[model samples]
Target: MDLRHFRYFVAVAEALSFARAARNLNMSQPPLSKRIADLETELGVRLFDRTSKKVNLTTAGEAFLPKARDAVRAFDAALRTARLLSPSHSRRLRIALPAETSRNVLSDIVSRLQQERVQVHLVEASTADQQDLLTAGEIDIGVIRLPVEKQGLWASASLGQPLGVVMAAEHPLATVAKLRLCDLDPYTLVIFQRRFAPGLYDEVLDLCRAGGYVPHRILHATRMTKALLRTESAVAIVAERLAKRSGEAGSKEFIWKPLEGSPLHWWSSVICRANECVGLTRVAVDVILASLQQHEGWVPMPRSVRAQSEDIRPIEQRVDSVNAH
Candidate 1:
């Protein structure tokens, strides 16, 4: 079996559906099925046990999956090493960070790295994509939203964002010194897309509901501007930094206050392959952390790190959040 077989096998193994794997690989289901069949025939063992309703890995498949993933990652690392040897890219470092990271903080990270003769191959990806890219060796280090499974990776201390309400200065609850989740009951909620950080997204809504926050509706927006819109009738759930920025931008049109119980929060961390956090990779993480703390006003921890719900929230909640704002 060649690299193509490994790639196809890994895709199918991760997705667990021939149809979904084919779509992800930009191929067809029939050909994908044939490739797996060819792989199994060559190995004299079956990898997946397929049923009409679901797909599963055989014992042999389960045993081989890690090795397969390692091979793919090794190949990718080799290519990156080869490219890094070139004079122009000798100090180039590949890293991906979350979308919500401040532009000024990003600029500071880039500037600091440049002073060390390191060039950043920065990719701004969604929270879901950071870990996948890091695991696949597509990036040397990744800054991802926290509370993710960190089984085989090196992670930094999580930096938490104090959660708050951002609303037009004229909104009914804007003048409150501190707000509770229940205070947002009457207005729609403006929040980020769930695909960015599934756990965090669900936890926000679940915690809100559990704390007696029953919004008239929920709205999700991929863009900051849209999420910040309709503030007269919406209460945007945001980090303190974002709230402050909005408040500054609107020329006193917006106000932000911490939650009364301070239960809501967001966290992020800098991560790299457990064994690969050295030299420039280490520098990148340091610069990011320092920049975030000093330039972006993010805290090392939230005022209150309440226990988060282990279970994901219902799908209908996500659907409503996505359908509006």
Candidate 2:
């Protein structure tokens, strides 16, 4: 009927002696005997055959023994699992990001968290999809690009490396120290589809329009490397870190260059729900912002746009500290 009753029943069932079961349970023989008598009465079955010298289990007691053991085991297992999954027990953060962004920054964040014994579940999706997942509660925080205008969402200052262009090594533009969007007008271009990278893709299109040429025969690919390898005539623009990882040879042949215009950079920020802000998110954001500051030549996002995300509130007034790092 109760957990204590089950425990008492198991002890008596195993030992086959009221005196031994009471001693094991640290209770007196009289109380233990009475409790077992009450349980048998409640169940409407006899549990033991007792004589002055010996005690043995009745058929009803034997039948209930395995069931009682199973109940105790199941309850204990459920308790253990709940403890393991508790936020305090795990101390891990569940984060989501676009694959490209994760490739650039997630590893470093994970390594830092590991030192603190915090585990991180890093899930990868397209930039837009990651945002949707973040909103849907599928992930706690997301690494996403700038100019994200969703309400109830907040973003930290740019976390890690900025985005750069990837072009084939043999391309004439690769010869330049740095290339601009204007410089790529003569060549066809390959880029991530608008669905995956609406903000960055639109920026590229706008820059091309300013240069007076539309991107010709633009090929859409889900993955950046696929877009690069599939297009021989078109130069693929990709994140700088991805360019470095893709290599110059093998399936994809490409080169990388920094866009020439002043402050020509694509950026990523850590995003989370404004209302859900908590200690873990703050700790993670601090670690990432610190890493960003340590790297040379990294700049914070502009004040106007940065002010929109709740994540910047704490760090906004501390600009000197951010830049000094």
Candidate 3:
């Protein structure tokens, strides 16, 4: 059958009532019944058991239901891809990111997309929540923190920066050239909540454990390092990029110093559903990688390689903006 048959079959299977399915499809019962019958005949099996009282899927119907839904979903995604590429249709890419993300990376990617005449709508979400949204198709793609479980999704670490500690400028540890994970054991540590970045959160804790220190007083929140360190003798582990953009760190108020021993690398990744069409999402992923490559610690992939399977044109111009988020 066609896509329409799959759509009709899904609606009927879900509703389990010809009258309800017809009404939901905005068609009459006879035509809807005929369509189901046609689909069953074409498939050489009955898809539903019908009687005067109720309608239910037979054994064969149960087996075919999932396949039919998959067909409809694929068809819908193809239509969405066509609509996205048309000049008449608005080319808006919906991207989700962690609440406390790098300012320069996001600004650079947005500037690049705007030059290509594409609009980006950004949503602030936790890394865990972004994964959920990506799987459900609520967002086009997401920038998530590393150490994430792929769960059969497509993801890669697109950008990385050295992780450091942010603390009050007057704190005793500020005089040191660099601080290690064990150095913060004396003060309360402020870190991102587990819900926001579970992988990163666990990594920080594990590092502390390895350093022979289990942080007893840890504050977990999604606030700026300045605010987090203001109330008490506390420190927050953050990316060097975020520390530089905070401005408070450079002033007399705060100080950011890299970790000693092996440095901790804060990584951000781009993720999308495994089966999603990559026409528009591919462009957004490239913009992220291109913008991040300018950073000191970012790893560059080969120019000839594509992150996604789709073939897309490269953005020719690089743009910069002063915005920070």
lDDT (Cα atoms) of all candidates against the true structure: 0.73, 0.64, 0.70
Query: Candidate 3 clash total?
Result: 0
By TM-score, highest first, what's the ranking? 1, 3, 2
Model 1: weakest 10-residue lDDT segment is 315-324
Query: Please, what are the lDDT tens digits per residue for candidate 1 over residues 106-192?
Result: 888788888888878889887677766766667877777655653457766667776877777677887787688887888888777
For 251-287, candidate 2 gives per-residue lDDT tens digits of 3456667666533456567677665545666576666
Clashing pairs in 2: 167-255, 168-254
- By TM-score, who's the top model here? 1
**Best candidate, lDDT:** 1
TM-score of each: 0.75, 0.58, 0.62
Deviation from native of the Cα of residue 2 in model 2, angstroms? 35
Clash count, one per candidate: 0, 2, 0
Tell me each candidate's RMSD, in Å, in order: 8.5, 19.2, 11.0
Residue 216 error for model 3, in Å? 1.3
Full candidate order by lDDT, most accurate first: 1, 3, 2
